[model samples]
Target: MRATIKDIAKRVGVSSSLVSLYLNNRPLAARIAESTKRKIDAAVKELNYAPSATARALRKGKSKTLGLVVADLCSDYSSFFAQTLLDECSRYGYQLLIGITHYDPEEEKRVLANLIARQTDGIFYALRLFPADFLKSLNLQNYPILQLSSAAPEFQSMELAREEALKQCAGKLYEYGCRKVVVAHESWANILEKELEAYGIKIVGGRYATTSDDFPYLNDTPPDAVASDSSIYARLLRARCRELGIPMPYLCYSYSLPSDFIDDPRVIAVTVSDYKTRLSGIVSRMIRMLENPKEPVAHLKEPVRLMSLDELREYRCAQLKDPYYEPFRIRIKYEGN
Candidate 1:
């Protein structure tokens, strides 16, 4: 059996109440001698006594645990986010419970419910296909729930404030003489189109492809460039171009590019935001909210920028030195040397 505070007191031959006061670092009465305190400390170590998190939480009315639920862990962004979040949680003396649901909405709901059932103090989510209306049905309106990437308006969010970045991206493309482009990920089509049009550029087409083979040869306007929200899709665009004997430069969001892509110049520009930094910012806010106990609020935005090919290399190269990059495959090569 695990040693309890009672065992420590018994071993020290002292009252449990006296031991409790010392263990909690509560002010002891003057009659409680310094020698008794030292004895209790030694006894605690000798008994291997550990505090009960459940009991402490019951007394404090909040668990020192947080939940992180993501759609997929295979991606670079997810791996980076999970590791950085765990590091942050450890610093705050909190435990983290992670759930990976592979973008399944039903599984997302189940994992979320389990987190709540387990009395997690707060939740950080990055669900691609989460149903906001169905979440409202859970009646978690006041809960400390924060979503990453996009603003749901229903949940307190740390969104990738995209307007500035998109503007810079469009300007960069315009500078490269790209007046027309096709954007992959149709959900972002209208937004990218609006931004590009601001720079007098036009969207020739849009495709939401999951596989390289899903890219179709577009006959409209013969785009000067192709932009994609996913690294995988951007790769497919490059493949399609090469297969057709056409040279093309593409743009991709920096969300999931493995750090190894720092050397690849085929990518023209990146809509860049530091996911680890944004996660840290929201986590600090969430910790404050949980400690103080308040109603959840509306959306919050985190600014992003556009990194040209040269700038992307410099930025990613700097990230290679950060501890967060240890999970990247590049780390294997880095450590091998």
Candidate 2:
């Protein structure tokens, strides 16, 4: 039979309530005599007593479980963020329940409902392509919901510094001598076209839905470089380049490239957001909100930087050659218009 609180209490010559309070680390338990505390600890060790998490949660009215929903599990960015969030959750004495929506609205709704049904105390939502009003309509009731990347006035969020990251990426690309560049996403292309034009770089905008083989308007005129808002698009561009037997142009990706492509020399530059820092901040904020739900919603932003080809290569080399080398110290200038 498993050792229980009553077992420890009986061995320590104390009340079960006292044992419970001490085991839970309640404030009142601190006032107990050191000798008595030592006796309780010794008794617990002798009996190999373990507290029941489920009973404690039931009494406290908290599940101690956090639900995390990501836009796409297949993407390296999402996977890395999810792992970081998991580690953060474990540090705060919470278990993580993860759900992947693959960017589908119906799947997202289903996952959210399922997580709630499983009695998750809070949720961390990280959707890339969600509609602006989608989260507002959700009836989260008393549960705290924190968003990553997506934003709304009703919930706390950690938003990406996309425009700044883009400017940095453009600067790095220009430094690489990319005079004409094709931006894969229309939305970002629209925002960045004039910005790049001001830097004397011609810009060609393409839709996000374009495929590697069927990219429009590229047959006659291939740009000197291809830039994408996502790693997926970057991969597609690489595939297209490989299929045509043409040298892959100087490529710049706004998001971290997938691990397979990270070392590819053709990928001239990338914009890397500090996801670890952002996720840690969000986790800390969420824990505080759980402790006091009435706390005002926080809007946090993390810094992003562009990594040039030379810097990336140097980092990769350091990883292979020097065990003590720190890659974050390498610096590059941002000169976008």
Residue pairs clashing in model 2 are none
TM-scores for every candidate against the unseen true structure: 0.77, 0.69
lDDT per model vs. reference: 0.72, 0.72
Q: Tell me how far the alpha carbon of residue 286 in candidate 2 is from the true structure, in angstroms, after superposition.
A: 2.2
Q: Score candidate 2 by lDDT.
A: 0.72
Cα lDDT tens digits, model 2, 191-302, are 5676688789887644343554466545767778887767777777777777878777787776432242355687877777544456678898889889999877777777
Error of model 1, residue 156, in angstroms: 1.2
| Per-residue accuracy of model 1 over 131-181 as CA lDDT, tens digit each | 667777777877788777556666677766777777677777788888767
TM-score of 2: 0.69
- Clash count for each candidate, listed in order shown: 0, 0
In candidate 2 the C-alpha lDDT for residue 72 amounts to 74
Where in model 2 is the C-alpha error above 4 Å?
A: 1-52, 128-137, 172-180, 186-191, 200-202, 205-214, 255-261, 264-266, 316-337
